[model samples]
Target chain A: MKLEILAALNAEREARRAAVLVTEIATGKQRLVREADLASDPLAETLAERLRMGKSGMAETPAGDVFLTVQAPPVRIVVTGAVHISQALAPMARLLGHDLTIVDPRTAFATPERFPDAPVHAEWPDDVLPKLGVDRYTAFVALTHDPKIDDPGLIHALRSRCFYIGALGSRKTHAKRVERLTAAGFTDKDIARIHAPIGLPIGAISPAEIALSIMGEITAALRLKPASAAQAAA
Target chain B: MLATDNDIMNRAEAWRREGKGVAIATVVETWGSAPRPVGSHLVIDDDGNFLGSVSGGCVEGAVVTEAVDVITSGAPKMLEFGVADETAWKVGLSCGGRIRVYVERVD
Candidate 1:
């Protein structure tokens, strides 16, 4: 790859945009295909599939064998609560190679000492999330159990393309929350996007176990087929 | 600090900007239980300094050594490591997985 191509690829990554580096094995000819240009590319369908999978592999075309380096944006986890569950989820998210941030309006809960690894924002989610720019690669989790904090964050997430939106609550609690969102003008289809009682059903009692379950659900939402991911989330 | 793939690529660009001969090796294909994924990268400088892993330390020494040569030659090379290859015994993946690494110099 040329230095210019490498520089451009790095720029795209810095901007958190997805791109593919296509390199021909035989000739070493290469080009960087930005996500915006995919629709017109010759390998649009294949590239789109690889980009969705976020995997790099070899593809055989009439030109010969080419390697597609699918550079998807790094997954980001934005938790609305810096509570016990968020504490447990922080390191796990980091271990799984996901960027994690803790947002809590309550200063006592959101503290740097509490979250040594992840960034803790002691501000309202509405004030912080817009700056974070939660994109499709982001996993938005509402764990505050406080509608005042989590509701606004959920509204932002619903407006954005974040892949996963999970809210930690009981079935009864979610039912009430659903009513509130419905009154807020969200239809059943839009409100259905949230994975209520957040996390996979694993009979988790401890906060750490709950964190594990949440991570599992997020992984399923990210890696599994969309239809199966919805079932898994359910 | 653990260096992510993004960090590795950024370091490669920084090394090039410093006028150091840099070569980047990427795992293009893998079979069986390969330690690293296909998109994993290992960036090396002319002095054999490298960051990141193509095989989680199993074949990095070989990849780094070959990367130095690619930096000097300015030509790309495809390296394969597996239980089936003779060199696997020297720098083989203990997990018995096959991986194809493409090493190219950054001009």
Candidate 2:
């Protein structure tokens, strides 16, 4: 009992250290803001007033009713296929603050020199993804166009709730892929979540153009509302 | 309260332990020469204590005043500032762009 009490106390202390709570007075909603201190911090006064009013939203601090809204730098992007599109996409994604990782069983394609800035994992998707623990913030793309590599990654991404999942293929290819996924027990809704025919319909032809489309779609997914909602709004 | 870099976490924790309320404001969307970028954040306590920033000091004073009211009334609000507004220019960001700030309480 004493040990359990000590553990509870430690957990409470850790939570307090990591998060600030903000409580909205009118709605009574509370949000946790991750703790961060950027000096010359412009948001300080605004946060204080919001706290006073009991407004609930995540901030980068732990004061008042303000809870911490933690932001991890270099958002993670995991690409399952190391195709030419992956090469172009990796660098472009890096420019926009994504920490890119390329995984492929093809030793020739997945190399540190080819993807210099990105972390290249020359392992099969089944072996790699489990260790990475893809989360809601991570973006996953299957560019191999080969079911042997793409299928397992798709299954993993679908199960884990990754923020963005795109596969490069034609509608016909996606249809065939859907058959495989359904046989493996993925529901219709789950299959629909995959952004196959990947990217905005900008009439992309080259590998670079395709990469741009994929990146644009992923960026929109991260910042704006869901694709269905965005279409509705438009 | 003024905070040193090392003391920020400790100060925030202390505030929470005292049962005080806190509010956060964020620059969710910006357009046409807004002073700050999207994802900028500001935090304030019920007594008007503050941390972080949203704008380039152009509308912080006004935001604080509004936050105080929000704290007292327990309401959330969205504030917009643009070059078209006289007060917005008076505060310093007269660059002729618009910014939307979302203010909410989180505790």
Top-scoring candidate (DockQ): 1
Error of 1 at A114 (Å): 3.4
**DockQ of every predicted complex:** 0.70, 0.06
CA lDDT of each candidate? 0.91, 0.67
Off by over 4 Å in 1: A226-234, B84-88
Cα lDDT tens digits for candidate 2, B2-105 = 33222333344455557776555667567788776665666677788876677777777777777777666666787877664544345545677877676755
Candidate 2 stretches greater than 4 Å from native: A1-74, A226-234, B1-91, B94-107
TM-score of chain A of each: 0.90, 0.70
> Among all windows of ten consecutive residues in candidate 1 chain A, which has the lowest summed lDDT?
A225-234
RMSD values, in order shown: 3.2, 11.6
iRMS value of model 1?
1.4
Task: Please give the range of 10 consecutive residues that has the lowest summed lDDT in model 2 chain A.
Answer: A1-10
Q: Pick the candidate with the highest lDDT.
A: 1
Candidate 1, after superposition: displacement of residue A57 in Å?
Answer: 1.5
Proportion of the native interface contacts kept in model 2: 0.00
